[model samples]
Target: MDTVTHTFFGLTLYAAVKKEGWSRKEKTAFFVTAVGGSQIPDIDVISSWWDTAGRYQMWHRGLTHSVFLVPIWAALFSAISWLFWKVKGWKLYGLGVLAVLIHDTSDLFNAWGTGYLEPFSTQRITFGTIPIVDLTLWAIMLGGLLYAKLRKISRPHRVYKLVWLLMACHFIAQSAQGYALYEQHAGRYEQFALSAGFVPGQFQMIGKKNGVVEISNATAFTEPKLQVELKSQESADLDKLFAANPKAKTLYEWSPFVVLVDNEKQIGLYDPRFYRNGQSFLFEAIEKDLKQGK
Candidate 1:
């Protein structure tokens, strides 16, 4: 899913855990430590994708996104929490571990599919669960969290635990939709490597229409997965891309500027680093080859 969704999920879970009796100062420290751990996996993408090579070899949620790293990563976060917050012993460590778990859980449902076992393999997994951005989910979650911060339970304790219940319900609803979509397309999906959105788990059908596609999660918040129009009905552009590239076999012949999808889902895409590997990707050289690969 999108980073915003992950941030909100982390916020909700981290807030919920503070009910375990930590001081406001300690809670803030815990939050900082936890969010850092949560955001760590995505850090690799900056260098990998934007480097001179433009190599997506370690882009975004790569090996750092592995579940196996949870233990070591949690320990690192815990040590940071202990030092910065002056927290003692196991309390800080426990919180850090929980925070990492929450981060992984958040990714389980969102789009972009996570590489939970990344170190072992680079496979990306998604339940085809939720849209990357869902305004309804955000409104309910962020709004209620803000409301809780504004209202007081009884004066001495300002924390409101009710928000947790709402979060739980929202997660449940999202999972239910995934199951429903699975049930609806079981045969067709299994017949091919297919992916479909599952959040709010509604039974609405989705497919291409005219020059575009539409998606309905039975919720106003969910937007279409991708909207595309064929520049040529015959896919002449694709044919030319394949014909032009010397390393055509290496790059699956996909236009990265187009919609994102795994290599397995589609065939022929260029490795991002192909153009960036050397200085040849420069404007003059690129324009020289635009006729075939653009």
Candidate 2:
């Protein structure tokens, strides 16, 4: 999820707390715990400043977003709350854990996955059942907020809880549709990935077989519309490219599949899942003259 969505998650979590008899200080402490924990994992973004090797792709959502680090973050938040507000208990720690856990898990549903397991495993776990910026989720949250204000509800926490429930249902529905589309086309390709479109019930299905990659727009209630086909130069010798640009190697490894470009002018590779508008944003290329030391 994007930064805005994550912040909203933190806000919703805070709002869902039933603090009927809580003190002002206690409420503030819990608020910090919820919102802070939701964003702490993204601290890995700072690694980009020192990323001379182009490993930022691998490091951005790397170990910091790992499940192993969740407890550590929670403990830190809990200690901070205790130090500042004199509020110390399992409740603070537990909410912190929940907030951080939500951040890590939510990242798994997008095309740009996270290193959820980290040191234990470097696999990028992604379902691609949700877009990076989901308007549906935003709408649900906004609607909940509006309803609470208009009705002047005494227990707004209940409204937020309902918002959470609705969001979960949306996720499940999108995942189910994506899964069905994947299964329908699984046999046609050796490797495949799903990227949920910005619109609900829609997806971009990417499949690779042999050296050919097929990208299609699909939905559960409609036939998949063929978008474009990409042919990968599977036999391309990438030794020079990898040697000159280590990020190219990282990109190759981090992506589920890549379309290798080997031609007279240049040698490069790009992730097919992000292909768009006759090019891919994730493309990495090097001139053949550079490769030949010209």
* Predicted candidate 1 versus true structure: per-residue lDDT over 54-161, tens digit per residue: 335334565667788777777887677667776555765665666666666656665345668866765656554555566656776767666776664332122324
Write candidate 2's Cα lDDT for 1-294 as tens digits.
999999999999999999999999899899999999999999999998888988999998889999999999999998999899999899889999999999999999999999999989999999999999999999999999999999999999999999999999999999999889888987899999999999999999999999999999999889989999999999888898899788899999899989999988888999988899999999998877865654
- After superposing candidate 1 on the true structure, give the runs of residues whose Cα lies further than 4 Å from its correct spot: 18-25, 49-54, 154-161, 189-294
TM-score of 2: 0.97
Candidate 2 residue-pair clash tally: 0
Tell me the spans in candidate 2 whose CA falls farther than 4 Å from its real position. 290-294
Q: Pick the candidate with the highest TM-score.
A: 2
In model 1, residue pairs whose N, Cα or C atoms come closer than 3 Å (at least 3 residues apart or on different chains), thus clashing, are: 1-111, 177-201, 251-269, 252-268, 252-269, 253-268, 253-269, 254-268, 254-269
What TM-scores do the predictions have? 0.63, 0.97
User: How far out, in Å, is residue 217 in model 1?
Assistant: 8.0
lDDT of model 2, residue 163: 99
